[model samples]
Target: MTTNDPAGDPAAARGNAARARSFGAVAAAYDAGRPTFPSEALTWILGPGRGLQVLDLGAGTGKLAAVAAELGHHVIAVDPSPEMLEVCRRRQGIDTMVGAAESIPLAHGSVDAVIVGQAFHWFDHARALPEIARVLRPNGVLGLLWNDADTVVPWVRRISQVMQGDCQTVTHSGGGDRFEPMPILEGSNLFWMIEQARFRHWQDLDRKGLRQLALSHSAVAILKETRREQVLEQIDQIYEHTARPPEPLRMPYLTDCFRAHPSEFANYRRTLDSPVAPHL
Candidate 1:
């Protein structure tokens, strides 16, 4: 028998295993094309801080680390990609290391909170959760987040359909596989069934930038050069469709936030299932 980690679906995780092992060329373009989290989500996760010792897991480009620092927290960024870490190192106020969700190198019980940006879907959460729980001070928060394009807009949705058409698994999460059915955390613990938030941003690109973004994807770069070119051409065609006559193309995003607290509540379950019974 085989099992997939934290947030991946069973069959999907099997399909994704080989591709998940490396993120070489996708590093830079991921930083470029991806959107950052909203300030509100950060505050909701970090709170109006006295000060926080935070971990940015799968901290690609130190983007969230940069944000956490701005919020007056001590931040450490971790990722497995050296090429990705090189870009992260250039960013100010971030302490970076080579690591992944499955095996974190930091000491046990070291952080006040952990924030996982768009990379949660890639983790083995069973391994990661215990490791994360170990490193976090008791009652510390864990935030899992993503910044997906706000594809509710007709053009934006159409663009996403084109960009992701070949990809079988469109929805994502690291929390998806691990945390559900434990308890559906509510009120503060859950967001509505559908949620959206917007930010205005611009990116300038040459063909190289375009290629960088294309290469950043796990799916696109995994293919051969001819196949890669075919996909790239398809992407360009889609972008051309979106551009009205003459307009520089830019994508829009709605940062989605999912936050959870490790409950002191789990102990109650163990107690009920305990072999020794106490009179009620």
Candidate 2:
């Protein structure tokens, strides 16, 4: 397929194709295989904007919620998958809610801050932004984050190419680097925090486990089960071709975060039109 205006409409195309991109196929593996954000990065995104209560939007497998809770902030975790939520529920003293970023289940202006991990790219930002803006208190903040493999590593590059399927370009744009560009949301998402961090640790996962992690991505989630199985087999070949010891391999990622607030209207409109963050 071709488009007349790919540059002006990349995001639109992404959104249109994103619905079928499955995120739950490897929910369990995602929880198990995905790395957590670094302490310094978390501090950068949320430390300065500490609030009375924090919400972790798209709190997949409770990764962000875990860190948010450590900050001693009252944290609420929200996601659309029961399987993913199940992993989050394992965390003690954590509040887990079943909701989408576009339709969070929290009350208006009821949160001090909202943060998301590795999942914001999957959201319909045009709608999610306004929804998020409505829920933030005056100068309240919103944070977004993701952990992507450092494919600059030769082996990692091959692995990504094999598993990314048809989405390699869209998903791996800019070398899988971390991004927190908040300007796109200027009218809606005002900048509050900007940070970049990297994690170099590795996990011991077999070809099957590594394949499972890729399958969990929303992009791969759109494939038919049979075709997905074929993708996994192909991924296995790539893994075998790359691994030296030919056993479980470790994956490394650089995590990035973006924090911002809802844009406020003019001085006169503020008094009557001050927006309230939504809870629904």
Number of the top-ranking candidate, with TM-score as the measure: 2
| RMSD to truth, every model | 7.6, 4.7
The candidate that achieves the highest lDDT relative to the unseen native structure: 2
The residue-level lDDT of candidate 1 at 130 comes to 61
Full-model lDDT for every candidate: 0.63, 0.65
lDDT of 1 by residue, 1-280 (tens): 0132324467656656556654656677777755556666788777887478889998987778888888888888998888878888888778899998889887655777789887766776556666665566555677766665556567556545544546644334211212222222332222122222334333445444555665666666577788778778877776666665445556555555666665554323223433322211
Q: What's the TM-score of every candidate structure?
A: 0.75, 0.78
Model 2 clash number:
13
Question: How well does model 1 score by local distance difference test?
Answer: 0.63
Model 2 RMSD in angstroms: 4.7
Candidate 1 Cα RMSD (Å): 7.6
Per-residue accuracy of model 2 over 27-119 as CA lDDT, tens digit each: 687776566677666676667444358888888789888887876778889898887888889987689998987798866677877887776
lDDT for position 58 in model 2:
83
